[model samples]
Target: MTELTDRYVWAAVRTVPEPQRSDLEPEIRELIEETVEAHLASGEEPSAAERAALVQLGDPERLAADYADRSLTLIGPRYYLAWMRLLKTLLATVVPIVTAVVFLAQFLGQGEVGAAIGGAVATALSVTVHVGFWTTLVFAILERAGATDAGLEWTPEGLPALPDHSRHGRLPDLVASLVFLGVLAGAVLWQQVRSVVRADDGSVIPLLDPALWSFWLPWFLALIVLEAGFAVRLYLRDWSWAAAVVNLCLALAFAVPAVLLWSEGRLLNPAFLDAVGWDPAAATGGGWTVASIITAVVVLIAAWDVVDGFLKARRASAPVPRHPVLVDH
Candidate 1:
């Protein structure tokens, strides 16, 4: 081989695996020799023939990548669609939940709307960056590893059903409901053991009235679990009169005791209220205003949920229209 051919061979084999380098070098050299000989047969000089051969083989690093089956792009065509599908799925599902959680935590913790919005937006941006970076890293690893399949095999079962107004849209709502219930349960349990508020002596003060833990809190937790199960059943079985009735009962079970407790001034922690200077007796910017607003929101949400459940049930149970057959006379 000429000087150019020698350098070309070295560049091609340098980055390839150690075990492959020995075998690849000879293979590449032989191919280059054959190409050079062909160019000589075609009447080219030795130097020109070698240069032509090297140019035909193109970039040695790219040639090495081809031989090693390594992807040239960050995410190659093989896994590009799958990566995109997963990224979109995660962003759609996770970003909103993260934003909502951050916003609620900030607003509830600090009572500052601007701070809550800013925190939520910042955290969401951070989460998006992290998710994108990690997902790309994983796909890059998989591509380098020469994985033939990325677990995104399509099947008949994956095909969505014919679009229906009620059932098709139910999935996202059900998923959201389940997630919210889970978070609610976690927050309830969290307050029992830890709190952002502390007393004068630095003792933790739970936001909720801890004395109710013996009965009301437990009842609320149980109702939440039942509500989750009901939500699942509603998703699976569509909806029926029985399901709607159960939903109404669950709604009442949650709202009634909650409102009653709030009205009786036994819902929130006295210490927490005192610490925050939120006098329950005050008419505004205080416990009374907050409690009344909360009570109204609770009742309104429950009523809307129950009514929505029945409406969906009615829609799901509606009969489909049949096409009339044409008669041939």
Candidate 2:
């Protein structure tokens, strides 16, 4: 009935394997109740007795780990190295590239180098925090779930004849894709309120139509979310035919909204063209042409990504060729 008792019992039972939980939960609860009652009988205050009983149980996560026979560390030794490698790879590669891109975009759009650099630093820090947090959280969960054992067992027969590093997906690529998508989503929403591009008269020119906020932008953001999801899937599954197929579908989903917006001539602001010094007639015609070309390019890239996925999956799934052993005569 006490908060401590209820919390402790819930935490302990939740970590137990689902099949055993139904049976173990009541037993643990009974034990806790018995311990609390004994403490109270010994002249301890009711609240203090409950607290003491829960303390004797120790941390709920640790107790759950004990129940599941899992290690309580954030990442177990079995997965620690892999987690470190991935974390380092993402921080080293994706963070820098994304930071640079953000800095340049901000600088070009705002024409303030100092502000752009500061913004870039802030963006980099945010990305680093998120990447580190999510990666550790996932590994921690995997550790708690006893999933890290998949890599713990090693046999000579299981070893690759030649070290094949190319089979695995690059962590940088996945992280970059996710980060870029996030930045793009933010920029899309930002454009609705603040203009990134400006005219000489000091009038702000938004990159996207403000009217999009009512209907089209949400769909556009949805596509971005879908793309981000695919990026995560690619990271988890590596290169696979199924992943490639889904990637292609996502590409099509992205292209559809782009094409519709372009056809309707609502994707980009007309003010943006004026600010950039394009003749009105020429800019209008050219914008449509460019949009059509871009749509085509997106489709091509999607096709290529699908093909690339299948190729990588094939290479990864292929059996390593064994060389003939020559026995001494």
Pick the lDDT winner: 1
Question: Which consecutive 10 residues in model 2 have the weakest lDDT in total?
Answer: 279-288
Q: How does residue 253 of candidate 2 score in lDDT? A: 74
Per-residue lDDT of candidate 1, residues 1-329 (tens digit): 66788889899999887888998998888888998899999999898988888888789999888888877898888888889988998999899999999989988998855566678889999999988999999999987887778368666787645555555567987899899999999999888678888877878899999999989999999999998998888777878777888888998889999989998999898878888877654544222355565677788998999999788667556565463121110
TM-score of each: 0.48, 0.41
Enumerate clash totals for all models, in the order shown.
Answer: 0, 0
lDDT by residue (82-157, candidate 2, tens digit) is 7887799889998999999998998799765556667898999999999999989988887766653565355567
- Which ranges of candidate 2 are over 4 A from the true structure? 1-169, 198-204, 274-289, 319-329
Residue 177 of model 2: what lDDT?
Answer: 92
For model 2, the local distance difference test gives 0.74
Q: Which model scores highest in TM-score? A: 1
State the TM-score for model 2: 0.41
Models, CA RMSD each: 12.8, 20.7
